[model samples]
Target: MNFRARGVFTLILGSFFVSGIAGLVYQVVWTRYLALFLGHTSYAVIAVLAAFMGGLALGNAWLGAKADRVTRPLLFYAGLELGISAFAAIFPAYYDLVHQAFLAVVRGLQPTGILRLSLQFIFAGLTILVPTVLMGATLPALTRFVTRSLAELRGKVAALYAINSSGAVLGVVLAEWWWIPSLGLHLTLFIGAALSFAVGLVALILSRRVEALGDGVAPATVTSEPAEQFTPRQLRLAVVAIGVSGFVAMLYEVAWTRLLALALGSSTHAYSLMLATFISGIAVGGWLVYRWKRQAHTLAAFAVAELVLAFTLFVSLWFYDLLPWWFVKLAALLARSDPAYFLYEWLQAAVCFGVMFVPAVCLGTTLPLVSRV
Candidate 1:
């Protein structure tokens, strides 16, 4: 299940890695599109993110059930990817209709203040949830295909997560730095859709030949609904604790991105760098967790990881205020030209990574580490 070596498992790993890349590409594309539609205010940004996250949560809860029961989870995953591709293919038309609906609702209701914001959130959520639900459902299917029982769940899930996150890092970089800059949005979307379709098609082909190895599934955890009742109080507490950690992790992401944007520029590219740096740390942390999965006293390891995560959060805060100082120094050095812009862009991304990387890693480690406990 490690899929570290060359073989069918390696192919599966690569497939999921590509899937992760496609998923993040869609996220970058969708977030940029929705931001343009809703306006780039703080509340608007949160609305877009909330909608995206909400849809994924819904998918994991609902479609995830199907993922659990399906004998060929690979096929289910293929179907989900194809569904996302289909949505992406039609998203341009749908994007236009959503704007029309937004305008119509505004004209009819003539709402103001909180009502206006609520309307924005509602429209933003509806606009994003369509494909994101399908996007959200992918991991559950992959997870079901990967492992069978609680015993095999720990390392395999952690490694798979790391692989997916690694792909996400590449996706963010490519979407923001390379694809959108060179190809433009609509074309970039076509590329994203194509990647999703390719992954699904490959998965479909693989599903026919390889059978799942695991017997029972302890599915990979994401931020979704509450877990079923645990007979043991300790188990219940651990589950709740991890849930809280995930909540706090999201708060950190939202807060950090909002703050970093002030220093990094609120351009679409800057947002992508912030996301990439964050996920990069997560990917590294997941890899670390996979490596250390067999440590004795798993609970202690989880607690220690949490403490490190908290400490890094404070560390990031200190670094956050220093970002402006670094930016100001660089501003004096650079000119308002293409080469300067290029230099400045990567410089700011580096600063973002420096501040965010460690904390995000700790945060990422906690999720899979908890499963070991």
Candidate 2:
């Protein structure tokens, strides 16, 4: 690669690393922190995490709509990174205050369990809303930075996603093996904040260089042949369908671990395994979709994938109770012998991976197709 290409690749890679660390911190640390402070009965932590993720989706939609209008997409993304870092720095204090406020309200009203849970959800949502939204804005913003053509757009987006997901997998492993034990919860947040800020600075600097070289201008619009023309409704439908598919795939992966844990009567470790498998599946799926470029039909593929996912969920639910005891016992024995927790965990992961594969592949195919339209 040339100098400019190398710089852009480095920027994307750094952003992926930062994103991975941030995701890992939230997944492994935040929930435990909340549980410790609010008692194990608090489902508020999960609620907060969910709200954060939802906020990210909203941010992506909002930022993407205006991506073409933004003169300095890198600056906007950097500002978001800084903002998220600042929040991470003060999250402990903010969370404690919110927890106390919740308790005081509960004491005054003597609310039922459901009411308390509602309050917890609200508190969690409030704490994570801004940062999560900001984090969500980065992907589309970065997409604009990296892509120059419709065909390149799909491959670039897929590559970036694979890089980011790989970072997340590493982050999860690091959090469990190093961050939580060595740095503790608060320090882990600070470490993630530092990484985010560093990545933002690098991206901003590289963007400035591109602008100075006159390489930042929008690519000239190509005249479409009559056969290539698409109605606005079709264009909008395609974009919306792809976005929805992406969101659904993410949500299902998020919830799959808990569902598996309930089925196996085991610890959350099984769920963690499922998450790892799902992310890996997405990375692999993106690669395969890119390789099978000519065979991809973005919308049709997405619908079929969604249907398959639904079927898988139904099968898992239906068969869970009827699973033979010997099979479960043998699986557990294999899991115990495997140092990486491969066997039992992989089984759970396989189910989650099956649910994730189709939608991810479909969504991966959509980016280039939609950009072309």
Candidate 3:
């Protein structure tokens, strides 16, 4: 924690923050683009989404292993970011190719509903998995780069994740408010590419500086962390909790969006804003984790976070009954002061915050604590 070390850590956090923004930008836009190609049916949309997440899972599983093993984790992270930018640049063309391939499958086979769904998934997966896999690898690489020892992981990973999620909050805001609305999706893709490229270049430069400065830390020092002593039972429980954490988070997002749409309207703004609210809560929770600076009791903390999250989720169901009343009251307040549809943004946010923020924060807290394992 010397001056030089702190400076280097700041640079790394800054890089992760930038990457977080670019990642969410890509995700928001990708859903739009994927929906166009895959159609708007629930089944089709889910298929495309599953493909998107599957790629990330694949990357986390595969490259996460390589992250600590790599001699230079910054280089590994930079490569992933650069690869994401490169693939994003070409993704439109790649998407069209996949679309053509999908149509050929339909025309040639004349597949039924289930077969078509499978085909949609296959085609969508083929189109998106490359860049997303790279995106997924980033957290592991960046986390490894920041933590030179098992003990160093205590709050560091969560703080890094917080910075990243903070960027994601802005990313969602930018895409919704300016990027898509101003530049259109195609041009927005280029903007995202440029962001990825910028981060990659920064990382590459930092890597060289680390070499020249010696940095008081070897490039390979992360690999020298003492072995963990978690028992088989502890490891198994932690792994299960990680899976459950992801599942519950995803379910909350999907459910909250759908439920809110029922209360609010189905405008694109509601969807985007709800998503932003979710990420913001996560970002807040991450900050809380770093600020708490408590010991890392991965199992106990993870379990408590999950339990609180579940209770919150159940409590939210009761709150749904009150949304109608809340909206009516909100509308009345707006009506008094010369309301406009644009003003509904406030309403959307109030409703989203009411139910989602706390649970999302819990979702944020769990990952960091559990990752200590």
Residue 268 lDDT, candidate 1, scale 0-100 = 71
Backbone clash tally for model 3? Answer: 0
Q: What lDDT would candidate 1 get against the real structure?
A: 0.80
lDDT of 1 by residue, 1-373 (tens): 2233225556768988997898888888888887787687455557767877788888988998899998899889999999988999898899899889999999999999989878878887887797889888887788777766655555577877899999989998889889998998899889889998998998888776664543323333432433322347767778898889878877887897788887876777777788899999999999998887344566677788889887877766666677788788887898889999878877987788777898889888887877655
Residues 1-373 of candidate 2 have per-residue lDDT tens digits of 4565766667666686667667666666666665554465125335645776788778887866566467776666667777777888888888888878877988898877787767767766776777787778877777776666664565556666667777777776666557877888888878877877777777677677775465653442343422244577977887787677667665665555445555443333444455566656666655555464442455455566557656766666666454445346556566346554655655655655555455454444445444444
lDDT of 3 by residue, 1-373 (tens): 6667778888888888988888888877877776677676333335545766787899988997898798788888889999999998998888888899889989999998888877777787788788888887898988777777766776588888899999999998998789899999989888889999999998888877784354523222333444346888987888897888888787777777677877776555567788799999999988887786545455676778778888988877777878877787777666444456558767778778988998999899887877677
TM-score of every candidate: 0.90, 0.80, 0.90
Worst lDDT run of 10 residues, candidate 2, spans 219-228
Greater-lDDT candidate between 1 and 2: 1
Off by over 4 Å in 2: 1-3, 37-45, 64-67, 148-152, 217-229, 243-247, 263-268, 314-318, 322-328, 331-373
lDDT of each: 0.80, 0.63, 0.79
- Model 3, residue 148: C-alpha shift (Å): 1.5
User: If ranked by TM-score, best first, what sequence of candidates would result?
Assistant: 3, 1, 2
Candidate that beats the other on TM-score, 2 or 3, i.e. the better one: 3
